[model samples]
Target: MKIQLLVLFLSTVISAFKITDGTLKSSKQELGFFESDSLRLNSTEENLSVSFKIKSNTKPNQIFVKLTNENGIESSFKPTTKKSGESYISKLSLPFTKLPTLFQASSKLFVSLVIASEEDKYFETVGSIENTPYLISKSTYKPTEKFQAKPEIHHIFNEAPQTVDPSIAVVFSFLSIMTFFTLIVSWGFNGALNFGNFKFDLSHFAFIALIIGYEVTFFFYYLGDSIFTTIGRVAILTGPTVWFGSRLLNYLGELRVAGQR
Candidate 1:
């Protein structure tokens, strides 16, 4: 009789529970309950809380709860005990920063738990994060205000080649300023410069156009998300820089020849 009773007791003890259903809610709304082995989390502007309920089983203290990702990353937490009517549940805030960066912003995360009162060992479960809404992805961003949503733009650049350095912008600006001053000095020498008998002031217009083109091209291309942007940046900047440099040299040569004559 003792042996039979012991076998029955062991059989009745649920060695583990399968994560059956999950519910998520934000401050404004319930995102809707989902049936999943893994909890889908979203990185949204709203604070999200998710709770997972197990199959019909006697609820224990659930003294230990830790979440792990596919990468073996882990975060341990103690959920506040609660009963929703008759059902037992444990709640974990989604995208928990409470623990060491529990899940990467948009990657799949696995879960692990142990009811210390019921068992001594922690075991892995099918439970995982399903979605990350506020995950800082490029697909779901809108720039409403004056480039207010810069992070979305920045994320695009992160996936691409390095942007133009600050030094490049500084160098270009200096070159533009110096070029304008040199043009003024050259105009004083030539009494208004001309090109090929067109009798138009090419110096002023060409210098301003090249400078504007250089700044605008590099600014956007540096923030772009393409391999070609990097390659094209070199080609683009070369055109304006070479044009300005050669034009300045040609102007100086003309003044020198006129002085010799």
Candidate 2:
């Protein structure tokens, strides 16, 4: 007996509630609620139609449909049923000519359904499914403009390359020969006298200074715009400059020893 009663109670609960369905269609899909479009506004009267379907097991005493804006202003419509049963179709028309103040601003619109019975009241909120319509006195956007391009330019020749300079190459070749001759002289003098004193002189300092200046200037020019360029130029220049500078120092030592003798 209790199982039968439970089944009957569950059936009655399910039968009491209803599901509402909504679909949006319009003469113009891209039309903004507040923007002027191909759809002609009758200053005398403007109408918007919303159609919906309601499915319920039991009959409702009153059905109320309302449209609300973003500002919470509501426009109410009481639908009169044309057909019997749970399915329904209704039209709502808003007259702008009668209430010009309502159309003054761009506003969002929402649709809600309210059903009332002797024992229960059911409320369902529907729409706002469309984009907020813009209200404009005039269209302000124009369609003609071109875009511009800016490119970065680098001066390649004005800045030294990441390789050794030809002028420095000649200087380095002279320095290498001078070093070999000086080493030969030092070995000869030490073998004969059994004692040798080698000293670096002013000419050696001048050679080193010139190489240093060249290196510094080369790096500064290479780094004109990029750090990677500076590092590469420095590495290339430093190797040759050190090799030649050491050779120039040894040659100066040989010169000083000959002068002392």
Candidate 3:
């Protein structure tokens, strides 16, 4: 019996050394989330009770419990702590309602201890406990339960645009053509086609080209192009057209004033 006790003592010392890098250092510190059935789950109260132990020289300032499920949901809570001789005992009561809704039997519970030494602050993870069997069996509701297939969706689209009567379109086209010809005839009779007073320079030529481009852009706009496209094109031409048109008008006015003089 003495030999057996000595062997057990050597095994415990070996295990402790292995955990602390083969050193008999009591300053290495130790922490544990469970020790011989320290965890309790109250089904009626819907609360989980956890007791963890930490052995450290420095007094801890805070104790936290972290719960994580297989679905990756996590929850954290602060626990109460009490000094037990040379070590500290921290206990937490976590409510089911306070935990993540997806937490299940496959969830894990982790405990952490935080210590502050002068200006230095550090935290240590005690350990993790997994395979919470009572989480599902004791629960009345399943928050992570799957549902059946969803209802089919039907889409509604706008009706296609209707076309105008071919006869009416033809009549309108004829009237448009006649009005264009009539305007040209009136302009010609009024000598509007005469460019004798206009300058034979870059400004005059650019002004005429820009005017024709502006008119053609509107004609295409009436034909099929979207309003936004036409507006963007018009905006591009507006600045240059205004500059050249202004120069042409001033030159023409100067020429008229010189003739009057």
Poorly placed runs, candidate 3 (over 4 Å): 1-164, 190-192, 216-232
Ranking by TM-score: 2, 1, 3
For model 2, what is the C-alpha lDDT against the true structure?
A: 0.53
TM-score of 3: 0.31
Give the candidate number with the greatest lDDT: 3
**Candidate 2: misplaced stretches above 4 Å?**
1-15, 30-46, 57-59, 95-100, 129-261
Clash pairs for candidate 2: 33-133, 34-134
Tens-place lDDT per residue, model 3, 107-211, is 454333343445334343444444346655654546554697778988888889999999999999999999999999999999887766644699889988999
Off by over 4 Å in 1: 1-46, 53-61, 83-87, 95-99, 118-124, 130-261
By lDDT, the candidates rank as 3, 1, 2
Return the TM-score for each candidate structure.
0.33, 0.34, 0.31
lDDT of 1 by residue, 1-261 (tens): 445323322332355554435555555445434325444444444454656665434666554455555545456677665666555677766434433443444366444455534542224343455445455352232434774535544334446666799999999999999999999999979877645433255764676676776677767776874758746765866776677768766766776787831
Candidate 3 or 2, higher lDDT:
3
Clashes of 1: 13
- CA lDDT, every model vs. true structure: 0.55, 0.53, 0.57
Report backbone clashes per prediction: 13, 2, 0
